[model samples]
Target: MKRLLYIITIAIFTVLIQNSCSKDFLEVESADKLYVDEYYNSESRIFEALVAAYDPLQWFDYAWGQYTHIGLVSDVMADDVYVGGADANDCIYLHRMFNYEALPTSVVSDLWTTFYSGVNRSNIVMQYMDNVQGISDDTKALYLAEAKVLRSFYYTWLWKLWGNIPYYETNLTYPYIADQNTADEVYQGIITTLEDAINNGGLPMKAGSGREGRVSLAMAYMLYAEVVMYQNDDSRLNQALKYMEEIIKSGQYDLVSNFAGLWEESGEWSQESIFEINYFSRNAVRSWSSPTTDGGSVYPKFIGIYNLAGSPDYDGGWGFEPVRADAYALYDDNDQRRDGGILNFAKYAEQTGATYQARYQDQGYFLKKYMARKDGNANHSADADLNYNNNFRVYRYAETLLNAAELIARGASGTGTAQSYLDKVRTRAGLNAISPSVENIIKERRLEFLGEGKRYWDLIRSGYAPTYLIPDGLYRTSTWTTSKKYLPIPQSEIDASAGTLTQNNY
Candidate 1:
């Protein structure tokens, strides 16, 4: 029997389960005995299945960590921020990742395990769709499409980080020993899955009223464009452009005028969001051991300034993921994006008359995009201060614009379209528009997405990682290599597979 623990939060559903986990992976959960047949005999059960498919998005062990296994790790691995905390040893996984010495057993390993857990959960829900009774065929098709797209989203992260990996569409049997697929095969599979969902699965261009968190055509298009763009192929670039253009023409999404306002609690689920991982604070109660409950995100609390006195509108935080001086230098002083993206700790101290000790090369700059507040938005009780109800923006309209710009700059049709999209993001940042060039688009994306967990992938996808990241003083030890691009598979997984699974050259 699968021992399931569902933490029902204000907005998102989070389910954690324990099955016969192997020595190598805490990922797979048996679905054979998930629920009795009568449980799926009602329409409510179908909705519950859909929610369960979405539940893994907020797992504390997966995404709500001090440095989220997926989102925040990319920036830390790149040249954007330092792993700032009490000392050098705090959150050793992030430090190791930044320095490029992460062992297979380190905290980063959990990302593989957890993301696969999401994949499996999505698979379970998808496989059981046929068993659902009395749901409309359209409704059933939409739910199935949602599961596939969500699986694609999860798999994209896995393949992006791990290169070639085991791929399975159906739920695995016990003692699972799956063969790994090449990265190319995996990418093609992901694209095919999403394309199928978009073309045939009856998903609306956008979710219906008040259905912002659910999967939509816009989300599918965004993911499709993003994955193909990462491949950097010319023929597919135009296809990606078409999808992004469709998203823009759909009129279902738009960028929030105020960049800073994007992070306010009131502005969550704003028009800018294409797909956002929902987290909640209301009705949530977190504990040290549990760390996350009620689907709240810990990224905000982890990146906030530590041990500082509360100001008029702000609160202190655990103070990990400090912004480096070089990252701060990326912006012009007057760039609203800078002011909105990073907390100027120097000026903050001057204003608040607060002082504190620094650690882990802290330059006093903190992440501002997801900073937590003390205004009763975090939790119903005084506890769980670390669990902030900040929804993680997985895909935004701004990014779609950027993607379209990059595609156009890279030989897609619509000459002025690239510059037009660039100007939109620039105008939002209160900056004058610059002519569109691939270099300019790259630089614009870096500046625009500072702490939003994109700069690193931007570097890699643009083929600039070796050029820009290697010479940076922040990277410890040897030079960066293409082989180092993928993190090593956990050794325990290899041992469990008994040679069925091969490890990446980390």
Candidate 2:
């Protein structure tokens, strides 16, 4: 089993999820102690600070009253999954988001703050690096590069979800007012920061086994690709393609031979993985009182089969983000992803005599990418559902190949041909190779990353959302429009901004 995340052992970092709208993480410290004066004087302490920076990554699931799994939330907004729960009111914000009805005072506000928390933590980590002593210059540079990567990653999420958002590298002071920038401004800033971190040249192409969860050169490149591609910054696309080619030529990663095996317990951190937002269950103390603890992921439990009975293959859960039957239908029967990416509960029940209490949006389909398997949370001490050993794979080599293919198809040349890259993924999926046209690349992504939450953003970045995100049956009556592209800023954030922050056109 994997070791517990170091953040879990540090109660000093437990006060991470601050209730303030300022995202006042700079204030997070021991009681009655000025930590800045006392800490970060040593290398060991600086490493702890670095791990603390990775903590908010786990918070998007349950740090606040209205939680959001970035993957599930993004999928719900797409055609692959539904905001499935006991009724229309359960995770009702997701339902609102699905129909393009989310308001300023919405649950997705938690997502905004969660990502900001990461930004704050990363900033704090960088501050620690500057103050730290007895550390090698190389180590300090590495830590700083990782911090920049993390900050840019969080900013990328904010930019995609809320185009107009506060941008800050240094922590905000009391009243915590950050300069609100337009989407293009935020885009430029994120790209600049990420580019510096990458070009500064300390990040590893692949983190060694001992540092599996840490940021790597490949992860930074992927984040770079995401931000530039999303902004449609054509000037940077060639550079982005070069980054993809770098990963491919390095030969440090490749697709796992067995497609379904990629999600199994043993498949984690395989050759295919570039980054994973980690979750742990061994000695987990993440109760409802401390959902932000370094424990298990709430995502698997949130989307697992609800009220499942006698399921030898899966565990029961709150039942949100049910996959669409039509999405499953689009897959070829011989495609391994059809079995690995989605859980056909109807077929399972018919074949094995298992059952579930079908709640809202019960199409008998579930996301298998991070599905809660049987006994997934059995080792946890409290709130079993809140803890499951599931790590969200942020980047995989398969995507590296796909990215190279897509970019090459769009006229960026590299070490490999577009057809070879596309063919590699297809042949691995037990399918024949097709031409590496941009359309084929897009369709392949829709298939390759079905429930992993790529469909929505893929549509958005490709300018396909307006037509591709059409109404789906009685569920999504509203088709996606340009105005609904960005989510509304949280009302609480706006109020705390003292009229400094502007809300999106939700």
Candidate 3:
């Protein structure tokens, strides 16, 4: 048990409980009143404000129809999996995203609102940090750094999803018309904020045991590099290379010997993890509550096997994001990632003499990375519907190595560093090391992180969407155009902006 205390008990900080769970693994409670003005006189109260900043990461507004909308669904929009569920109309927004048919509305709006909620909370926390008295400057700096990094993390999602967005560092007032900043402005803002946290904020290079869920200096370094790499600028790639090299040399992280073991409950916060979003079903008593009170991720429930006439190993779920047959075929038979990364229902049925019932767009496969397990440890939720304890590894050491390799291939120094990094990942996977190149790096990541939410963004950011996603059977849409590169600003947001916000050229 990680200190899930932050999720269950932080509600005492003047925020009434209900509404948003963590999207980045931060648990949330409703702020019945703006407590920042009245609550920061004590050190403990300051800590609560910091935790509140983390809340929007896991928000799931049931009334607003925002159900676990960030990480899992974001990946489904990519070319890796079909929008699997009850039917074609089920999660139709996601299906539209999958087919490049989504407009600026509902699902898009919900995601926008959720991330901005985080931005708002983070701003609140930072403002209140200044009013605290009797707390050590060091303590204040660390907490402030964590809040700033989290705010940047939220904006990274916004910038990546919608290129033009309103940017602000402090709380805003009524009529709330924030002029949209250019994508470059948003990127620069994220980079500057993280760099400040890294240089001035008192964050340690690594978090001590029992603190892996919190932001560390290493996570900030990783985020800095990831943001720069996404730009695909040769000079920035060189800058990213330096940050990655610093992390590698520090030896604070490494690849877990067993890749498959990384996803198991036992693997939570393993040595290979840099930043992991914590989730728990423990001490939770509801089968269904407003997301604000739920502590466990809904990922397992969303993608678990549904209606399987098999042994209890296949627990029932809503069966969303069915793995594509082509994706299963992408893995070599000997590769460890194949069996560990996916649930091959056909193969499971063959072995157990059980029936794998089909669902909407059923492709005979499902993501195994976060599926709910039958082991006794899973039912920590009293309601049983809320039972799932898996944590999401936001940044893993293996990704850092791959980033180094990709950067080197793009144009960086340190001879053989790229190949050395690639070899390490491949060698662990039971294969001979191939020479490092952009093509091979992309291929390796596709296999290594399937269903782990890396594939689609990897292709899109690398500018390969046209080639990798446009085929007839690859996605519902047979055509890919440059205009589809960035998602449009949510229609509601544009309307609310009253001309201050401009839509993307979709």
Candidate 4:
């Protein structure tokens, strides 16, 4: 009887254990709980996280690919460049000195989300780096440095767009509200981050064999130099000039012979490129080309017009952003970039059998810089499949040379050598060089970096954005003030903070 009781007890215990195991198996883990802490313990996992951080930087809806919108929405609108008709108001407001209170939802949302997303990702990487093991100290430092530089880049955008922003160093673990930091404070933070990366050997002096998309020490310096120039602080400019000179003397990069090559499909990862947001044609890769299967490229969806004659022009998508006459007139007749970079609306209209006359009722031409060819389509009929591999050029060798020249000219010596820098850019564009003057340098910068999103900041730094009115009837330039230099803090951010954080003046 005792033996029989022992057998029954064993069976009962086995049944309970099996039942508990089954219950545990059925429980689901929450996705939100999965974070940097859970995955960044190994070198391979850390590398994977690093790649994920880069993903946001390459998205078209973000800064890397949405160059046209960012630039036009800020200040440099092309008279003929139109898509979705969103930029019409943007150009008008930007040129005519419209109030920040009047900005469209698209502009407000895109700028807000892109910058925050980039900052959040960078913060995650930085937060987890200390926990990662099995990676070499050099490799670990490089990854950390890259994150810092990228963070600074994103902050620079915030500082430029919304002058006062609540700075977040790492991901918040508890509910918190912070007020906007002053513009100078934000810039100083960026300077300190880049300088630290440079001193710690965190950035690559030159591109490694497989590290085409990564930022080098020289790129960090170039970005720092740009920030200093924008601030117009003499001491900062001198420091910026010193770094620029170092990059120029390094001999790691050069100007590509053909200017168009900088934007071509094949020209990506070129020697002249200091740092670029990498986009690939692979279906699994989240690139501009993989829109439906992944996310679509903004260049095709936003910039590409329906081809009228060739096999791919069926969709009657309206081009929205157009170039201004003033901008068009700035380019010389022989400027190779003028024809290659700016697209004429009438030509596109003639090809598509659409009404071209009223295309730019106010300004006259649309942008051609990022138009897709018929042969480059991935889906052939769908506008989403335009897979041209045009990498966004963030830092280039030519800009470095120009930075160095500008620094020397602006120094206390006041050597009046600004014209030489302006001439170098002009001579490259197949135009005659100009005399060294601040006006010439400003003009050169406008022409050189047109459509690359530098013009608005250039205007701000030169103290001309507030006063520079567009000739078109769309804008009156007098209304813009120093307050207009920074975008108002988004209402959503303020709402989230529930009045704890101060909002910028609208």
In model 2, state the lDDT of residue 406. 87
Task: Write down the TM-score of every candidate.
Answer: 0.89, 0.94, 0.90, 0.80
- Model 2: colliding residue pairs: none
Question: Candidate 3 on 201-231: residue-level lDDT in tens?
Answer: 9998888876667889889988988788886
RMSD of candidate 1 to the true fold? 6.6
Give the alpha carbon lDDT tens digit for every residue of 58-121 in model 4: 5433343233335445543322222234444533433322333344322344566677777877
Candidates' C-alpha lDDT? 0.75, 0.84, 0.76, 0.60
Candidate 1 Cα outliers beyond 4 Å, as residue runs = 1-39, 60-69, 289-293, 376-378, 381-383, 414-416, 474-477
- Model 2 segments beyond 4 Å from truth? 1-4, 8-38
Worst 10 residues of 1 by lDDT: 1-10
- Kindly report which residue stretches of model 3 are placed more than 4 angstroms away from their true locations once superposed: 1-5, 8-38, 60-63, 285-287, 375-383, 414-416
Which lDDT value does model 2 have at 340?
80
Question: What lDDT score goes with residue 401 in model 1?
Answer: 94
Instruction: Give residue 361's error in model 3 in angstroms.
Output: 1.7
Q: Which lDDT value does model 1 have at 120?
A: 82
Residue-by-residue lDDT tens digits, candidate 2, 280-372 = 777777878888777888888888888889788888887888888898998889999898888898788888888888879889888888889
Cα displacement (angstroms), candidate 1, residue 204, comes to 2.3
Predictions ranked by TM-score, top down?
A: 2, 3, 1, 4
Between prediction 2 and prediction 4, the one with superior lDDT is: 2
